[model samples]
Target: TGESDATVTNVIVASHYMNYGGYDNLKIASSTPYPAIGIKMGVCEGDSTLISILNKGMDAISQKEKSDIMNKWITVQYEHGVDMKKVSRIAIISASVVLFIFGSFYYWNRKLKKEVSRRKEAEDQLRNSFDEITEQKKIIEHKSEEVMDSIKYAKRLQEAILPPTSLIDEKIEKNFVLYLPKDIVAGDFYWMESTVCKESNNELNFIAAADCTGHGVPGAMVSVVCSNALNQAVLQHKLCEPGEILDKTTDLVVERFERSKEEVKDGMDIGMVSIEKISDTQSKIKFAGAHNNLWVISERDDIGATSNKYELESVSKSLFEIKANKQPVGKYEMRKPFVTTELLLEKGERLYLYSDGYADQFGGENGKKFKTKNFKNLILNSIDKDLNAQKEVLLTNFNDWKGSYEQLDDVCVIGIEI
Candidate 1:
């Protein structure tokens, strides 16, 4: 009866904590109990394990003793046992949660650092690419400018080979040269000279116009070669017949270009006319043309006694039937011979020889060609006008017909009066 109660679970054990005085008070309550057997005893109070045992034990006790012992003992025991374990588990879970939060923050911080470094690398690569593109653009611009300057200088060199105004003036006595270049250089060239044939000692005067293959720089280069050949033929080689001169000139061009292994098919379509003034009444004439013609105008006297309107007479005819040598001055061998023809000129006669430039010029509002027939008409139309006036009118008509169209080819015209 004097033994002390110890705690059975980790909960407040009131029996263990109470002073000796508390037990004495509990003794007085127990001593003064009523007459009933349950009333005579104090209510049972214990730790969770003890309360459960007491609850089971109370079933064996009388019904009169059940209520007081079960309510008090069971509640106290549950609080000390299951409830205390719940508190301990809660504390452990809260510590785990804190650790999880710190771990997430650490992982995200490392991810952010990696992303920042990648962004910096990408930006640097982009900047380098942009700088390279800018430098390349500058290089391309410089190269383009150099190419344009080279083309401009090439144009100047090609022009130097053309016959100057002073040179043409010396040969024709009085003449007008309408020279137009298609590009910066010309593929058409004209030449003239006054001399006596050495073999016959006859006063000989001649003019020639030529159209080379192609039209721009390549054509201009060919023209230079051809021009040198013609100059050598007349001045150095002293060739007599026009056909013989052309044949010899072809041989020279072939020899000059042989090293390049290039085909010598390149040559000029040329027209030449020779005038030998014998007397005031008449003159001996010899003309040759390759795919072109010569026109002459003469005044005819009517001896009839009736008054009549005077008509300007056209004496233009082919110096020879226009034909090719059946071969070009090239690697290909030619067995055929070039043809040449001669004609006589009467007094007060004017003749014209020209390149295809004038007839082939594309003009008019519709950009149509000034055809050969129209060219013939134009020549006949100006037969009555003075030579200078005729040239002026011809230029005026061309400009008027051309309108806004650019000249498609170089134009050259040569007229001679005997």
Candidate 2:
């Protein structure tokens, strides 16, 4: 093929020519047998002498020589060669591809396993936190129940110390007490006691409306101390005059508080009245107060003429106010003896003694205080009604004024008709 100066050539050749003895220098790409021919030679039809000469030469060749020629030309030999460097390169590349696939799979599997573990841990922590919160809620509810129970028991004790309704009804024929506590136990209380005067032998009924320093438990405790002091002053000391009784009461309360090592600054604001009936049409009243007031409603022209200390405001024609001292019934920087106010009460007149809770309540459309002025107007309008009806009217007005607002403090109002 190189002798023809051809770079590449394809030709149909005899199968015998592919071996080493025939065309040994040529690289035979492929070979196929020609089935139509064996060992035949072609010649011209007019070449009789050449044909006779080729036939005679072929007959002269020996069998051994022909066998050797056939063996040399037709026998197969190893010709195709292998490239070791290319085979090694293919082997390394295939190994590297398999290793990469396995490595990626391993990395993803480990990542998925870690994610599942983290989620499980988070779920466990959440469950633990929920359990702790539920336990704390239960504890808080139990403590609250205990506190409520104690407050209810304290209410019972507080009720025991107050004057019974039956006693008030028996002593004062026409009377109504409006008592409302902001909490379970209130600091506001109404008290009454009956005693006969030593000199005049006149029957005296002493009644009081008191408001302590605060409301609820602390106020109730102070009320207990103060109520005991009042009882001691009236029963033990035999004090009849309203001013003397308050003076003795202040001494007793101060002495009782002094026994405590800690400084006790609790006290009460009280309005007390002692009523003595003289006749069917007339009665006498002596009142004393500490930061509380007495209100007398009458149709008589001389309502405040008997008492020099009474105030008659033009806002209400039938209302008279006996203002209390500007100090409480406890420790004060400018303490003085409480004043006793004397007045004459007719058969059809009414008396009101109360704490500041009613006037101090915050409500109405403007969410303002039910001020003293408005309270006086309400009382003046309701003066013509009976004691029971007046109580109902007061209650209704208080509720209406309060509306959705919470009661500010303990409220106590006492009314009496002579």
Candidate 3:
């Protein structure tokens, strides 16, 4: 390092730091003893306040930490080899030393000025470069916002396509749709349609909760496709059975996506239910699903239905979970026909169709998923309350379960009183 130091003529850069290291002796004369280096931090005569503040800050550090830092620089075997008298004489001739120190400081200041000038020029160039970068960043951000705006407009269109609130309220006497999108738009969608069977002239109320393969834009696109397929199956094809609609929807979605040259495998999992009122007090319900399940909650009390929510809250309720087909709506290796399960339900029973979003959400005290079993329990517990109160309780429980965690997926829960 000394050889490297000797190679350079003016070593101002090393002058600041070289003194921090312990050395045997500092020799600046022609007859030298060792390398010459020194480092000292000081304030001017009028800077008592600055020194006091610095000391106060330094006092916060532990004594051991400060000692360790000091010992690293001041070696245990350090010997300046100068007595007090000589140093006192050097102080007595303070005027001459001050002149020399001032001259050296002036020389260093000149060097510092040249450095500052060079750095100023570099900073000007860097500032220009940063300005260009900032401008480009702003442009990129604007374009991104515009893209998001377009997507938001697309979300509005998607919202329009969903089963209207009026329609659901009209078809089902008491219903609650708990729909939450992970983003501005969602892949999980709920749809309901009221139709009359051509054969028997019976009114069929069809409802479905579907979860697409993805979320956000891509999933929403697939949802749109699947929803259209459902529409075609009911309105165009006149197919009312849950199984028939599922079959037609799967076919249409697969056909549409496969139309592209790249083999696309986009699909969805759906739980569909068709309800037809057989009598004033009874109804026939057909259910089908693809990787989704259906839940039915019996009335808390069959006694005279009360208008108040708290009146029925104390009554006990039971839940029934029906498993679905293992296959998805899209292409699968072992594809089988979607089977429809037919059931008869009494008045005051509630039917629940939902995506896996709620159950699969990651949250809780231990940060675990709210699995399907627990979700069924939640539905069963809330079944005693009125439909609107049930919605409030479910959302409150979900929020409590999901403390500060993000919603993992799109959630859609549809409950209808039979």
Local error of candidate 3 at residue 314 (angstroms): 9.8
* lDDT of residue 140 for candidate 2: 90
Error of 2 at 392 (Å): 1.4
Worst 10 residues of 3 by lDDT: 303-312
lDDT of 3 by residue, 1-418 (tens): 4433232322233332445543324322222345655534688888999988877878888989877876665433323446679889887799788989999999999999999999999999999999999999999999999999989998998998898888889888889999989999999999888899776689999999999989999999989999999999899998988988898988898899888999888899999999899998888888899988777766443322211222223447656666688999987779888988887788988788999899999898899999977887777766668989999998998899988999999999999897
Superposing all C-alpha atoms, what RMSD in Å does each candidate have to the true structure? 12.5, 11.6, 27.2
User: What are the lDDT scores of the predictions, listed in order?
Assistant: 0.64, 0.84, 0.82
List the candidate numbers ranked by lDDT, top first. 2, 3, 1
Better of 2 and 3 by lDDT: 2
| Worst 10 contiguous positions by lDDT, candidate 1 | 24-33
**Least lDDT summed over 10 consecutive residues: which range in candidate 2?**
5-14
TM-score of each: 0.57, 0.72, 0.71
- Candidate 2: where is the Cα deviation over 4 Å? 1-119, 304-317
Measured by TM-score, the strongest candidate is 2
> What is the alpha-carbon lDDT of model 1 when measured against the actual structure?
0.64
Instruction: List runs of model 1 lying over 4 Å from the truth.
Output: 1-159, 193-195, 280-283, 299-335
- What is the C-alpha lDDT profile of model 2 across 1-418, one tens digit per residue? 4374222322324334544236655554333453443565679999999899999988888999877866765555434446578888988898898888888889888988898898889889989988998998999999999999998999998898898999999988999999999999989998899999776688999999999999999999888989899999999999998888888888888888989999887899999999999889888899999989888887665775333223336433477777788888887778899989888888888889998899999999999999988888888877778889999999999999999999999999999999
